[model samples]
Target chain A: MENLIVEGSHGVYFVPYVNFNAETGECELAGESYLEDTVLFYNPLLEWLDNYINKKREAIKFNIKLTYFNTSSSRCLLDILNMLKDFEDEGGEVAVNWYYDEEDIDMQEEIEDYEIDTGLHINLIPSTDLVKHQEDDDDE
Target chain B: MEANNLEKKAQDTNKFDLFKYHSLFNQNVQISYKGPFDSKVLSVLGTYIQFTIGKNPKASKKIFNIFIELAQNIAHYSAEKNLFGVEEGVGSLVIAEYPEHYAFSTGNIVKNEDVIVIIEKIELINSLDREQLREYKRVQRNLPQREKGNANIGLIQVALTSANPLDIEVTLIDDKYSFFAITVKVDK
Candidate 1:
């Protein structure tokens, strides 16, 4: 299966950088997500996940790192999380890691709320250590 | 008796002053969110608000949050539709600035049945002092999670973040739908 990649934009519609690999079963959505057309923006991502879960049924590792997102984006995020919840219910191996800025109290609370809303165990990772690791990767 | 009379006159003057002040600063920008509220439009407008109003971080943040929450509310809940061309909610959002603060206002057509619930929630928030509201939020946060799209925490967050109580006014547009208008203030 081919990987799905969308080159992110920082305009009126903020697109979150996405990297979904069918081979490695790794999906990452990062950056700010304030989309002009949220439903359209997220529909393909949902379709890809559904296809993977139904056909390939692989272990998926999902990572979310968003610094800022409007309330409209929050609804789309919930939809994505619910999809993942369903995938997990179907006996799929799923792990979600939510990276947030430690100092942003509102963001931390939002992550907690998402965990409550999704009923999926999400590891809340601080960005400091992750940034350092990413820097190391860039050096290599 | 004399003091009571003086107090009454003072109150009347205060009311007049408030009316005059609001009228003077009533210049507003109203935008309609049809299809997925264009994030590009939002960002550009948000930047303009920030630049035009002068950059005080707190004020800017309040305006941004208020705009996002109000816009999303319309995008998600507006009952009127123009067809499948755009899955957008029909609503109007207005941003007005006064010398002391900026007022964010949103109005949209909603089912008449939902008005009571919305009013009750706003009244509940208004009834609480800041500390109590904070505690209420904490309690809500601790409660077992509800289904997605069921959470009513947006208004609470708006009240808390803006440090202002939500002021809502509802008008009966027709038998089936009511126009709900909510305004919140952010100090400059």
Candidate 2:
């Protein structure tokens, strides 16, 4: 499977950056997303994950670092999480980490809600300038 | 002749007073616009909110998100048309500032029959407290997209973001259309 790379744009609408690697099974979505057509934009990312799990059966690592996203995009994010959860249920290795602005309690709560909705443990990481932060910290 | 001249002056003064309230530069409103809800207009309004809110990132973020979510509602669902054959929707939006919070309001014409559904949605949103609203939003979000009744997800998000209940007012215009206004308060 080929890798997918999309450069995000911040114009009349915000588009989040997406990078899904087929070889490493590492997918990262970052930046702000308030799209003109949310589902249309997210369908490919969903498909990529579909192919990775159904065809390759590789271990998947999904990293999300969106600063902001509208409700529609939030639904799409749930779809991604649900897909990962299903894959893990079928004995596939999956990890989901969400990085958000520390000041945004709403966003932190949003990630928590996703965990409750999908029944999948999501790692919530606060945004910081310092690189190489430890992942074993508390999961607030 | 003098009496007639005085009456004419009175009429002119009344017209001037009406114009003052409708003026975009009216001091009562921090920002106001009446036109099509196009991308260009959305960008300008977004920047204006950011600039006006200044250093309060928290308020700025809430107001901006609320504005975008509601403005897009007008753009997508308003019964009125701007470009006619084109797909753009037309409406009016205003942001009024107060000591504690900014009131963001958007109004658009909708089919008279649709007013009840709109009111019911707003009422449902207003009836819920913060936690219930979050739960409602989660359930609604999980539903498949493109469902007709589920379009209020944007409104739900606005409530979640602003942490304020929606204040909605509907004014019947004619047999076919009514002006529906939804307002949200974003605290500074």
Give the DockQ (2 decimals) of all models. 0.28, 0.45
Q: Which segments of model 1 are wrong by more than 4 Å? A: A89-91, A128-140, B1-23, B26-43, B49-59, B72-103, B106-117, B124-164, B170-181, B185-188
Q: Which candidate is the best by TM-score?
A: 2
- The weakest ten consecutive residues by lDDT in model 2 chain A span A131-140
lDDT (tens digit, per residue) of candidate 2 on A6-84: 8777667777888899999999998878777887898999998899899999899899888778877888888999999
Model 1 root mean square deviation, Cα atoms: 10.5
Candidate 2 regions with alpha-carbon error over 4 angstroms? A129-140, B1-28, B83-85, B147-151
Candidate 1 residues B17-130, lDDT tens each?
Answer: 445444544345333232344344456666566465546655775677677767667766788754646666777666766778878887888999999999998999999997
**Model 2 residue B138 CA deviation in Å:** 1.4
Evaluated at residue A36, the lDDT of candidate 1 is 57
Q: What TM-score do all the candidates reach, one by one?
A: 0.62, 0.88
Binned by DockQ into CAPRI classes (incorrect, acceptable, medium, high), candidate 1 is acceptable
